[model samples]
Target: MEKTNVEKLYEWLNEAVMTINMHEDAPYLDNLAMAINVLFYHDTQNLNNDIVKKKLQTALENIQLEQYDKMEKSKAVQLAILTGMKQSTQQQHMMTPETVSLLTGYLASKLMAGHEKIRIFDPVSGTGSLLCTVIDQLQNPVEAYASEVDPTLIQLANGSANLLEKEIEFFHQDSLRPLLLDPVDLVVADLPVGYYPDDVTAAAYHLKSDEGHSYSHHLLIEQSINYVKEAGYLIFVIPNFLFDSDQADKLRGYLLEHAHIIGLLQLPETAFKSKNNAKSILILQKKSEKSKEPKQPLLVNLPSFKNARAMEDIMNQINTWFTGFKQN
Candidate 1:
């Protein structure tokens, strides 16, 4: 699509976001609904005006009727960031499908059985989908910390958190920077892909590319490892392209050295229907004092699905793995 045309879509979506911002109930839903409508209209071959209209009506009806207040400001921000994301291709800053899967899977794994005082942090939180899911799935994350370089996204994330009634500390900074002085028990994040950030700005500190070069993703992995205390677990969703890449190998080695490689799930392509790309989830836990040697990684390649069920199954498996580990 032409940039101008995309801009028009942005205008329409942003207007919807403004409307949502004004609504105290389901603030993000308005923008989301508008986005769906735009997609349906633009989908051409798959266009369904009737379906789109029905969906919009349903969304409108579902939004809780509530008074607007200062608290609903974040929802407005979410709409704005989403508007930027739709056109971020020009900026070479696309949030890939694999990243979303990894974030969702991480939540599923941690929140399955539920717990008290659960602390979660997304060092590279985007629109805060993962964090939002975490808050909604489990009762409440006692403490949630998230950081993103983009001010727009940070605002959106914060807005989503408010809408969901999830308490969180939103940080608008690069995840590569030094983090909390104390470590948390669980860390869930997705490292960005190569190309856009450039080598100088990439945050891969714990990885080495196949050619023996470093990438930004390495930085994210290393920080995650360092930010979690002993017995703490870190789950990362990485691109397949990085698996055999030199940096991928370096990442694997670094993680193995500092932690126990518990499980490696090769995710299906369909896990990310919004975009095309095969991804994998790497589950690492700091070597417990009880164990001396590193254990082999349990690699599981999830089956592909044409619908959301595939994601649900993947989430189930992740939770099961965590449950089985606690039992063992």
Candidate 2:
């Protein structure tokens, strides 16, 4: 098969970034941000060598950024960042898988279909994968906000959003902390799973543990709920063990007080290397006077992405359920 436009674009970016990385030895992901900045600004940054500067200038002259659409641009960004992430020894930066991002985006588009315009936020927007995917998938105008704690990932997110011509406001801080943000109509995130080391911040959350570190995912959920409008929908890619752990009761209690579960569709087992690592798409609506529980939540065991026929059947059923649920 011929290489896609996205692959060609990614190759172009990778070569350009590698040229810079070989000199500066800056982290590879950081080089990607620099490459994008140079491409947009038509100049090099912090590079003293004449040879490298000339190469970057020549590549900038030959580039046609507008030729690629959002899908191509976003995929290229993911590919470049993914390559760098694998080489890094510093942190385990888990990206939301492309299949999972596509599915979650589709769910979000449907969830907010009736609204002509809305605000959306992602508490943990690593590399802008899930949030960007959702923004691209939606049909209406959106006000997008995202926050990230990691400096490298935040740089990559800003660069990618700029390359895609998306107007996003990002806060470079820990999302679990108080954000200077207003409530949003929707929230979509690939929740960070693990213990939150910030005991001071954890102490403020209702989901905080009695002993030791608190579950970061639970605190993020609470934070997201706090920032969503009443009856607003949220879609999260959460670990399968989210509701079955020893702290499960605590999480359940928090949800009951603040939100209503609309659905939980377990992602296909084959999506992950281990079944234990498999995740689910959890759809929630923050509680309010107008919000009512669906007759029965859209519980589903999703088929593998490769099984198109089965996946289509399941989606149709979900669509029908949503139609009725919205009417109720």
Candidate 3:
């Protein structure tokens, strides 16, 4: 029987996942590249069975065999398994396709134009989704940087970048500290919520200490602001409760004192996988040459959302902004 394209795509994606799961030294980047490739070639039919095996076989063979030659299988396998299984540990932290689309859409809109060399950074980069999306969507080649406290996730992000032919400086470091690198023009980060660190005993780890005064999102945001230039833009996706809490006024005041609040996009409850319904986008800008001090504070409310439609609209809006910049 001739298999439909949908069936072939299903088979491909499944096989790719299965193969990576089995290979001891399979680079995490290769899996991302394979997944992305499958996403591009996917159809409704192949999402099920046939084409997957062929795709998996090809992806597996395409890995750099020499890279694995010096590596130890046990360690590699442990890392691979840890990463493959990370999403299954806590259902709450897993990101949905809608979230992925939103991240990519924002990047597409904001940084697509090659106007003046643009550098992008994500401090709490998870599995490199936002960083990769930004890299993949940019019209100009960007010097991309990302930091993930989780070593396994860091490996996955680095591996994905290698496979995609995307260059990014990814570090397994505490995002709370001063950035060891140069200032970025734009910063986009999905701040961490309640999630355990991969390492429990590391004293310097952010999640390790739930001190009386630290590990708060407000503090995290304050630290992140240090990484941006005086007039750079920061797009932060945060929990909804953050805007209504007692700390909200203080954080808002702090942000207003330091930066310009350009836009805010509130998200639907289902935008996150958690039962906690807190999702919102804060668009902040540092003092720029084109900036104006307004008499009144500005607030923008977003329209109701249907994931697919909203994502498309957001992407279009972003493209429009970039296109306008390109024209001017």
Candidate 4:
């Protein structure tokens, strides 16, 4: 297939990003990439090396235009910017495309049954890809909310949302801290995984031990679960250790009591080669006041896929599982 003009623009932008000498200027690069995407979406023919360089040199104006279609070009722009940031700054703030698609497909299948409107949130929103993917996949009217600690990433997320003409309530704060908002219909995130020093908030959640060391991802899971309305869903991309590690036993017990584990998809080891972590997708429904003890969660181990064809097969199997779950 011949590459479109927008695709060529992305290639040019990516190459330009490599020539940047200062790491601190990566945020400026992010902003420039976003501007180029918006402009290209408006008029792909006008985009070229000279025009893009001119736009980046000048102050970018707000774009008021129709929403871009959900095509490769639209997705590639944000991805190219995110890739540039990662390469220059060595930051991890974006989810892989496969992870985004799997989560979005799961939500789309589950929500297809019946729902007029929904509220979705991502506590560790990163660049807002998870929330944006959900918005792109679902047919239901959705109010999206997200929080990220990085101000630059927040700007990029908000810019990407604007390019898509989607309204999102974004917070520039830590996700571990208490939020002053109503519980939402669903919470989805690819949580950051690591050890964190015990804080007052961790103490409040009872996740802090006398030893004063707590796993950050565990705390994020607990906090994200709190944001979910009763009977609502909490879906996360988490380390596979959450299922059986001795360190996570207490947290698992707490979840077994407070929420109904709906499903777990164990991803391939190569799923996040960038981070070198074995991860999985966990789906849970907040226990309703009158709901009975939770049933055993469905679990599926995905096959490793080295190419696009294999990935499509994996997605097909996932859709089958989702359909079965919805039926039962």
- Tell me, by TM-score, which candidate is best: 2
TM-score of each: 0.65, 0.95, 0.65, 0.79
Across 259-311, the per-residue lDDT of candidate 3 in tens digits comes to: 87755666655555564855777777776676544333223334445556765
Worst 10 residues of 3 by lDDT: 69-78
Regions of candidate 1 where Cα sits further than 4 Å from its true position? 1-84, 90-115, 139-141, 195-213, 273-276, 291-298, 307-323
Model 1, global lDDT: 0.59
Candidate 4 segments exceeding 4 Å error: 11-68, 89-91, 244-246, 290-296, 305-324
Question: Quick one: ranking by TM-score, best first?
Answer: 2, 4, 1, 3
Give per-model CA RMSD. Answer: 10.6, 1.6, 9.5, 5.2
Q: Rank the candidates by lDDT, best first.
A: 2, 4, 1, 3
**Cα distance off (Å), candidate 2, residue 152:** 0.5
lDDT of 1 by residue, 109-182 (tens): 45334455666778888767666655555554457788888754565556556544567888787776676546
lDDT, candidate 3, at 49? 43
Say which candidate scores most in lDDT: 2
1 or 3, which is superior by lDDT?
A: 1
Overall lDDT per candidate, in order of appearance = 0.59, 0.89, 0.57, 0.67
Off by over 4 Å in 2: 1-4, 45-49, 90-92
lDDT of 4 at 5: 52
* Per-residue lDDT value at 44 in model 1: 21
